[model samples]
Target: MASESTTEDHSAVKKPNGFPPLLSKKFGITDIKQDAVKWNKEWEAAIASLTAADVLKEISQKLDDSFFTPQHMELFHKSLRSLQTNVAEILSNLLNNGHFDTIWLLLNAAEQRKHILEGLKRASEDPSTIWGPDCRALCPEVTVSNFLSQSGKGFIDFLTRVAEIFGSPITPAFLPNSWWEQASNLPNPWWGQASDVSPQRQISQSTKLVFEVATITRNQFIGEWQFVLSSAFSIVSDITNRGEGMKEVLHFMENTKGHVARCLAEVKTTFRDKPIIRCENCTKTPDDIGQNVRFMVCSVCKTKLKFEVHYCSQSCQKEHWSVHKKACGKKKVTRGLSGTKGDFLWAFSDSDPVANLMRNLPKKEGRLTLRDIGVNPCNGKRSPAAERQAKMLEADKDVDYFLFTASGEPVRFVIDDLGAKMIFRINRGMIMTQPTDTTGVNAIGEYMLKLMSNYPGLSRDIIIKQLCEEYGEDIAEKIVELEQMAYSSDLLTVRCSVA
Candidate 1:
């Protein structure tokens, strides 16, 4: 026990309530330096056994056995109203040096004194302690209204915030030079808040995101100069089964070219791990940015790909469908008798897949080039000089087009929506003799009938009235009166008309 200085007095003074300073040394708020802590612990056990016959004088004597000075007594008496308040002040001063060991005990004393102050105010509410245990986890940001701007200013500001709340002398070891000036300017690539971060905490939270990216890049770039690398188009092949895939994975381990040097051309390669790509089809254009596409050329085919297809994340690029589907059937030869476009044929040797489509098809009598089937726009009866002069004129004029086989059989051709010609063979004799086998008038009539059946609103005779209105009464009657046209007579007339 600390020995007391008494003036010829065997009588004891009353001890400080609940916390006699010497007995409470182990749990006191003042952060004794380690040497001071060792001495205090040795003395505390000795003081705890004393009877509380005199509360204040004995405890004060025990504290005086150590370096309890007159200055400390004067400060304690002048600043605090009670012993609890005095202990609270001592704890606050220790915390300024950044020690937290006695924080829990100090918190209790502060709360008790705060209650006394509240009682005097007579509202009878329990006042709050700044270090109340319940608050530590729930609060996220501490606002220091005035932030000092200097080198390590952020860290100093943080330290000050802690001192103001707890008590001062927050230990030097507890605060680190915060890297906020450097790191704060960097983007929170994941969009975390900057205010929630603290300079006193152990273990940086950023290792998982940053380290994983670095690992991926290192694994990818290992064999830089080993093989002759060929262009590989991963984008299209990744997106679908119908597209071609990567060329052979070049054995860069066989480094034919200086691939290391080549790859290093990208300054400071960044590897993002487990990055997520929003589905391209689901992403909306930025409301403010307006819509314009970023184009990336495919590595293999040089086909222009949109930023959407290029993939925002590596995982999306990799997890796409693995195999390609065939564009055409694998038959060795064509089925049709024409050397026409769209006719099936043998794959050309050394032919560009994009061109020379039906060039090598087996020649047969009825097979013909489009040029052969197309009208020369000059009569068989005309000479070369007349044909040359009329070429441009014929191109400009509307001519009746005949669809025919190489053998001169007339075939039916309809231009589809996509502008490709679809050929159909029909009985020319039936087409010629029938009053309306494929006449513009019959097509119009069929369309009207379908519309009426679907809609069911309009009155009957709508189609007939429309035809009468459009072509006049004479053509309408001619179309209606014919039960059938005489085939033989019409055929002869048609031949004459053709000749």
Candidate 2:
């Protein structure tokens, strides 16, 4: 506590309620050097007659004679241990596990605080603290109000808001440097008003006893608050600084990324579990079906033709056969270059023989090389034709594989290192069907379906619609027609086996 003279000097300075007075103009706000000098002189005078032995004896007597019983000390220790356990559990669940909701609350605390204040105000008829526009920036109202409201969530919200404002753990500096001196001068009516009776006159009465009890309670609260805050600050500082070269920060960021990835995976799984397209007969989307009703596509089209024509049930497909028969065997429509310029499509799928061949390339106890896939290495700087081949071969070093078009133009199949995305670009000339190898041509058409599977975020039908803009839908329909014949053969074999 500041001396009575120093406190009286500062009491004269006045400022608006909930606002601080200017440090220089304020009467009680003395320089740190002046405070240090005065404190040193007072301290020396007080301790001049007290030797080290006398000080130790006084302290020992106070400790032994104190009213705090052994039971009270045990309870105090138990309370501290309980606090530690609770704090550890909270950190493990929220911080260590990287809870999304908790991270969101921390990042959006400033914006969230507005709604929190509004909700708290709405919950109570009249808030105890003054939440004037100027005072709203302070957190004591939020902290006090939340605790009084008896809501665990409200307290967490208040703590998050406080953390955001402080940018660190709470410390002694949370209060102004001269808080003790300014306490008596507070604008609050209860604090500012002086008692009329003298302490000497009231000493014999119940008023004295009440005053002593209030003083003891205040001192005990201050001691507990200081201990908790200091212990927390120390622990946080140690853990944060334990790692070298900002490793802890990096580790925390990695954990956050992992948490976000898990959240995304869960969302993706939810979507993948549902049907990708609507029912062909009723034109009803997945949402239209009952929860227990499974969405299905035409098995004849899917298994044999690798085409998907969706439906909610077999009955709908059967009823719509008359209309669907006209285009039942048609391939899914595809568009050309719908994405950003130079954004090549990933020309790969489980059905594509080339993709399967590339994926299964031999890795005989080590990294697979070009020789393992039967491709000869380019030796560069031969004839003009050889040199041209050499450049393409050099490019192949970075890519997964290449497939040549009917016009002999090479399409590069590159895999992204970071994102693991497969992409392909046709260097020149359009892919067309040839009499010798129509299989290769059909593979390109299959890539359109692959694009839909690869980028699930985009609608499958929408991708087909866009693909139709570049490559006519007839190419797909032709493949579907061929697939129908193949499916008929498979059906005949199955029936023969049954017979």
Candidate 3:
């Protein structure tokens, strides 16, 4: 709160709604600075006294309350401006000290206040007349510039650091929906309503700034595409599994998918005109070897072929053919074999579990990834079964399974007879099964299957303990021996770790 004398002095300068006047020509710089300092100190005190819960409660109140007078709007602007200044100061200190978590919280709070302001602006009569001037007065650019200048950082540099901390692009995803849309309608802080400023000049400067930021941001995001996509997918999967905030999470996923698509498009475009310097298959450079290697472009991208791939050797080209064939000439391919079938399989094998699992289980047409068994790699709404499967897969990263099909379609399988048998059922009326011994092997297999069916990522030690409790120690040890043998022989692809 400002001093009584100061408040009284501003009384005569009040608007029709009895609120203090805007920071226009009527208010002197001295008065504005004094009031801003007072308000900023008050805001700091208020924030310090309250917990996160209290801040959230206040935000909720602001969001729910519809009837805000001009006085309320003016007070809100003052508070927001004060908060922004404090946030900037805190952010500068945090950045200097490398306290990223605190910085994230501050930025998140600033974003929430931005949303609250937008909500107020939207609820007002003639939004342009009511909140437009206030928005221009607030001038986010001032806060941005002050923080960046104090921190001795440029916008791109600041954003890059933010991206590294957040593990995502520093885009509107960090803010609420409609933030950019609302900002676009607001006045540019750099080029205000000055008589000397032309509309064309304003547009040109704004466009240049937008383009510069967008280009750098996009490039940075592209460089971290693997991490960006992986982290986004993980977030989406976790949210879906929790079964909370479905609508909001889905909306976010949709936006993220668009970003991923854009990044991929940029990658493709970047490669389009560039000379091939390395083997696409092995990712090796000619400099790695003594001789300059000749490269073979994909025949598809060339006149002779329909696939887009390059290799330093004919053997490498031939080796990648099975996976590449499925994606040749298609607009997009969701999954491609990363290497030779054996290489792909070997990556998942500390033992021959995959090979053994394939041998014991019935052979079926088509490849199956975790997705085929109900795990989803992308985000959004998922079936309850899919959600469960995803949770199971996430619980353990030590094990992985994938099935490849000639047709590039998913293969589905079900465990039958309580692990005594596994049925591979395909659409083409094909079935395969591995017989289990009636006494020792059958019971252990059944138990193992049931345990894994419910909890795919359960630890091996837990399973062994459960087996010991159910059967005798001798039988449990025997089962473990057999399991290890099966895994070693590639007859079961359950355990990915080496014994």
Best by TM-score: 3
Q: Rate the local accuracy (lDDT) of all candidates.
A: 0.25, 0.33, 0.32
The TM-score-based order of candidates, best leading, equals: 3, 2, 1
> Could you tell me which 10 consecutive residues in candidate 2 have the lowest summed lDDT?
334-343
- In model 1, the worst 10-residue window by lDDT is 223-232
* Of 1 and 3, the candidate ranking higher by TM-score: 3
Query: RMSD to native for every prediction?
Result: 36.0, 27.6, 21.0
For 292-365, candidate 1 gives per-residue lDDT tens digits of 43322123222322212322233433443132012112222212222211233222122332113234433456
Q: What value does the lDDT take at residue 356 in candidate 1? A: 34
TM-score of each: 0.13, 0.20, 0.23
TM-score head-to-head 1 vs 2, winner: 2
lDDT of 1 at 47: 31
lDDT pick, better of 2 and 3: 2
TM-score of candidate 3 against the unseen true structure: 0.23
Report how far off residue 453 is in candidate 2 (Å): 6.7
Off by over 4 Å in 3: 1-282, 285-296, 299-302, 311-499
